[model samples]
Target: MRGAAMSLSAAASGFVVFLLSVSVVQGQDDWGVTYTSTEICALKGSTVDISCTYRYPSRINDHITQVKEKFWFTRVSNNDYVDIRSDPEYSGRVQYIFGNNDCTLRITDLRESDSAEYKLRFITNQHNGKYTGSPGVTLSVTGMVTDLQVQVSRLLVYKSYNRAELKCHSSCRLPDHLHYVWYKNRQKMWRGTSSYSVSVYPADSYSCAVEGYEKFPSPPVYAPRVPSVSVSPSGEIVEGSSVTLTCSSDANPAANYTWYKENEVSPKASGQIFTITDFRPEHSGNYYCEAQNRRGRHNSTLHLIVVAGKFLHSATHILYQKS
Candidate 1:
């Protein structure tokens, strides 16, 4: 149901060179099955449908060769096949669409493991009458995160803003005219092309998705947000007491925290949490933490004032800004 409208595109865009596979007809046109498409390429988390039609003689040997049962399968051993609907891996996600002489297999919430050769089989009421479609359809479920990516090319970088071009790239070759949907901060933007260009800020994140399969968007590419710092002991700092300073920032690919004191040429620490075992006047300077990633960096400064033994103020003051 996720891609009810995209079923045709999903089924058609298997590959540039299409191959037709069908169940070979028996002698004298007694029985046969014809598949709609031999291959399908669909998004990892979307739904797909594989359809086929079959034919068989109405009467044989003075007895009717009526169809008894029909199902789809992906595996076989010693001439035994298990229906995909009964498989635990496909529980509640597999369905069969049926019409006169036509049957379609619908699988929702598809996974990478679902990529396999799928075949349609039917059993007739006649003795030893069983037919399985030959050369089953091959399904390829591609993951959006790895298969699709946003390529960033910076055009200009200034102190206030940045201008860049973002391109939606796919490892698998897709159709040239496939529509693309751009997203900023997880919201849809007014652009629908393979490439997008816009002005971006340090806090903005961007992603893209194929039209109709918006649920499986590519991983967001973003710079670090403004960092924030907090003191573990939220009380009056006493002399010789341990105090921990923690910094955090929201970012894609995660941000690394580095602690530094004001006017220091080198970093004081290399983690999110920095602890001062003995709180004293020397540690009362302006301390700050820098959160950095591949995209950009930000910092938060904390002013710590330590009196001789007790407090001038109970709470610490934190200042956050872009760096």
Candidate 2:
């Protein structure tokens, strides 16, 4: 009976060893690395995180030991690789999140130069136990721009006054923590929110910009407003006299001025001021000044009459004949 009991115990121990060997073989066959995302897109001046998980056999050739080192790299040359954390370009911007079987790389203040392929490598204490994940994540960094939209209230406040609403937007949904800024005629008018409301006025010009990037504001937009015309002489225009017409308007980026005559398809002059030296009778016509910008355009008209020298003399002779 004692011999039989010892034999049974030895057979059970052998069975357990056989099962352990099979388990080790299965784990080794499944050793590999996988990334959460093969490709990732990030905005310039923003932050991004790349994640990965790795697995390895617990025992290789009956050798079991702790992992010696792990790191991330972009290139491998001549059997040598440089860790991204040690690279000068990523000195302050890169951070590593490491775990027993998982790792993550975080990059902040991203720039176009940060775009690259990133791979993770690990080495174990066992001799010649090093593995690198091939075809790693690809990172793409792009610039962010502000977009501005204008909306008008359908209902008027006082039966004739409508309010204009300006909203700031971006291509990618930005964090709600970020604040917005509003500008009119290059002067800051509002801040703290993405939307701003104001009394509608044709003469007002407006634009939107982000808080950190005030210098690069969105293109200005303005509702068309009638241009104001002023003559240099400030009186009746006479023939053979030099005359100058100045056009002014309240427009974002300032309005471009163009002078046109009635029945003419083409503009007679282009600029804020139009000058006609030695004015002639043919110059007498209905003139209009057009103020335009990227937002819209407006026109204001003025009738310019030039009296010939001969007409004044004829009028004086008629008065003498009547006397």
Candidate 3:
């Protein structure tokens, strides 16, 4: 109800704010306030304007009702309304603009705590000419840094590609009609709905941001890239010698690695590094590392050969490398 005085009350439970509207009685219009809007949703570190017009009778008990003071307050402390401008938390951030029968409250550098019901209250020269606009305006501020996130969901992974769902998410409720911008490798891809579906590749990175705040995009999310396998000694796996195999991959959520030898039903080892203290011919085979995450997995193979037995006992060296 634009400019209509309505009795209002609010109750906050958890993260949700609820506003209740009630009918105003007749004769309350003689001195009442009308707001341009009753609800506002803004992003953190942004600015907002809550404007309203007020009314008062010309005379009370035959005395002129001269306006003495007008201000905005969200609550009453010690049975007195505290002016928003005087609040230390809002100091240097609140500006009041008064025009012909209208008053606008301008707030800058908004914070999540600024989410509250703001009301317009005024005092007149007359003894009983004080009025407060009930159920004023509700301001809900979302975040610019912490809350915005890109949530990744793995739909399906087949062969060399993975089907994924990406959602632009926030801690507080934002307007449902907000246009979202998607980024692939930090480059703008398209502007569309908040949720997007795309085929994922191992080397691609994805992020999301609101349309107007592209610079503050959510952290990039990507699948594990093809892993690279390496050996510590890098030369040869000699009999009764120790050797270590390491697998590494780049992924948003770090990938977990498993070591397996060809023809083995179960995994040989679990971790980024797999070590064999006593090298033997039985360990000579095609050993592959599987780097896996929620997104998908990739394998890198390393062929190992042990230089043992009397035939090559004095050979001292055997070449082993990753395949």
Candidate 4:
């Protein structure tokens, strides 16, 4: 009976030892930090968030404790890590979000100089219980090109013909190596340089953006093309008939229309449509409509001829009398 009791006691002792060994192995396996992503990209003047989760043994050397200190560092020297939040460059820009075992670092108003590798470190109340994540998160910051502007210039070629010159501009100056791209009505038209010149008509719409960053393009600026003019009562113009002249142009911010007669320096009418209550020979002359906006202006011309009804009847009567 004594031998059986000894065997039972030894078996119970070995079982306890085995359970302790399993618990140690599980604790070691769960006592490390992990990051969701090791690399991230952010736009300059924007914000970024780095996330991670960490763990530690609940009991170290038979003593229970809790986390005492947690911070993020960009560099370590001589077993000492420097906290990024304490740096002057990151002051007021760095924020920490801490949960049970998860942590997040948010940086706002990011600059190009802020790009670097960041590591998370934590210390527990237990003696000599500190850990730093093996690998850190690397951030790359890039600038966004904005405030694009378009400038237009007109040069007289010959007689009444004029040539247009267009140049794309941006408030933020980028590297000279970066090129400019031009878009016509949302379609890629030119790529290479900032300036593009062409004889423009009223149907052309233009926008511009940087070469690498095409998603954010400048608001379209229009080069007013020659306006299309239409006169009411399409056939022969008769005396004492109301006539309407309509002008239309394809332009950004819409085009302002002005009507003028040939050799007249002032506009005879305004708006997209011009009305004449009674048509007469005095109104018969070369007429033109101008389409204009802040970017540019263009004009189109048309001629009108009016005939009196009495003149046609008098000619017919004279022919009958001669016969």
Candidate 5:
């Protein structure tokens, strides 16, 4: 019945009808996945490994085990992903770093133009049938610049105070891991996490250094790197409550925030903040924000409490900071 569903009877002669039916049936046939690349893109001009593993459906793999073939499909822009072998432009730049249930790709010396979507694809035979694969990893490339930026927030500088703490943020980078350093007036300071703060610089110049695969001039004094962060409010305040999470971070490039909750990573989750425009006891959770800089991430142990569950917008900031 699986294959027979595509056959059009004499009762249906329209090509559009046949095509529509094929699409509907094929929609149910999907590839399986397990592991995925923790990070999709690396620093500008660096090596990136897009890894993915999969287990075919029991009906598709029966008891089969050995893999017999492998290949890849590169997404050009949108709507089409073709073999890299056929495109002269990507010929030498693309290489199969490794292939298997865990297929990976090595894209070297990435340039801005190299910035786009990529994947690892393949196929293998199993006892049940031909275990063709739709399994793969997504890859994105980013630019690497040593130049840094400086910023300060909620600073309480006292008069005659010998020092003030200021933060640095590096934005526009996509690397998953790298080393971050603090620099002041051309000298290296202590290396902390991505968020580096030096005792007040007396109205002087400061910068940072992020070393990875990006190489150019003797890495100039870059803008300071900021850590990925989000602000949340306390949840105890309401039914029909309002909230917002301010996400800010430092990296050689800007840090991107992807919100998550419970068991859902992306699609199943909703809202930047859990806005209980209408209060309900069901709106409670151990809520927290996952902040990530290009190099690492930090999670706050936070929870949203809906006491008596009343609704109001004034408590948004309090609820947001709760977690």
Candidate 6:
């Protein structure tokens, strides 16, 4: 009776081993299959996907069994899968993409550090005490832009403080990822985490800037735009005689000035100076200047009054009488 009991115990142990072996070969469900992903993805800052497809080799393509649970493990993306269960780093953020061969791995806010290859596979306990899985898919995420682009705008431009109009302009723009700031001579003028417009003295230089994502290549520094200016000769001229009028102005890129004759409707866009060599009644009138820049043109008026003939004109007249 004792010998018979020993035989029965050995038989039971052999049976258990056989079952375990079967689980290992049949892949838990004894479907006799192994699966893995042949797909590959690029890099971070961009996006990539890992997909898996499998079917039983023992059965026809149409007879393949569907593995309900599929998941992936990533080294860099930190993406997790819920259907196959994943680590905490990727939990909640991952989900099984229904009706699709690929799972939805929404990597929020892509960063540079998210770079690495990932593993993919399926899980099953169809054959008790055994679990089956497919090989992992290798992927690489690449960073596209080394720096973030910034948009810039100017709120005010002027010449002499308060005397003329101050102008601001929108120069360049990119993705709305950056905050705008203004500067002059390397000094931060306005911190517009809120707005872009600013008013300041004309003597100071200016520039606009935008920052976003804390990335490099913020914005290229641009020279400030300056208002155009014009002026007549600084010295005094003889009365009843004509004086040559001159106009000038300063601007970022140089500006153009056109001279308008007083009472007359045409412009003398010629020499810097308009010389009326012969002083006469017609030589005097309301004098003004028109200044132009990339933006457009503007006018500044000068009320010039010519005095009576001076000693020089008198001497000339006397010489003419003698002749």
TM-score of each: 0.54, 0.43, 0.55, 0.40, 0.40, 0.29
Higher-lDDT candidate of 1 and 5: 1
Q: Write one digit per residue (lDDT tens) for candidate 1, span 129-179.
A: 888887777888876535578877655666777787888987554555568
Per-residue C-alpha lDDT of model 5 across residues 38-106, encoded as one tens digit per residue: 224434445444444444444443554555655566564575556665676666666664433455454
Where's the lowest-lDDT run of ten residues in candidate 4?
A: 314-323
lDDT by residue for model 4 (142-252), tens: 676666777775433433333567777764434344578988877998898888886544455678898767988988876565577877767665678788888887776
- Provide the clashing-pair count of each candidate structure: 0, 0, 0, 3, 31, 21
- Best candidate according to lDDT: 1
Query: Roughly what TM-score does model 3 have, to 2 decimal places?
Result: 0.55
Give the Cα-based TM-score of candidate 2 against the true structure: 0.43
**lDDT values, one for every candidate:** 0.75, 0.64, 0.72, 0.66, 0.41, 0.38
Per-residue alpha-carbon lDDT of model 2 for 165-279, expressed as tens digits?
5666654444455677888776898887777777645556677776776766877767546677767676555567787877887765467888888799999999989988887
Query: Between prediction 3 and prediction 6, which has the larger lDDT?
Result: 3
Better by TM-score, candidate 6 or 2: 2
List the candidate 4 regions with Cα displacement exceeding 4 Å.
1-45, 48-206, 310-323
Listed per candidate, the RMSD to the true structure in angstroms reads: 11.7, 18.8, 11.6, 22.8, 19.3, 21.8
TM for candidate 4 is 0.40
Q: Which candidate has the top score in TM-score?
A: 3
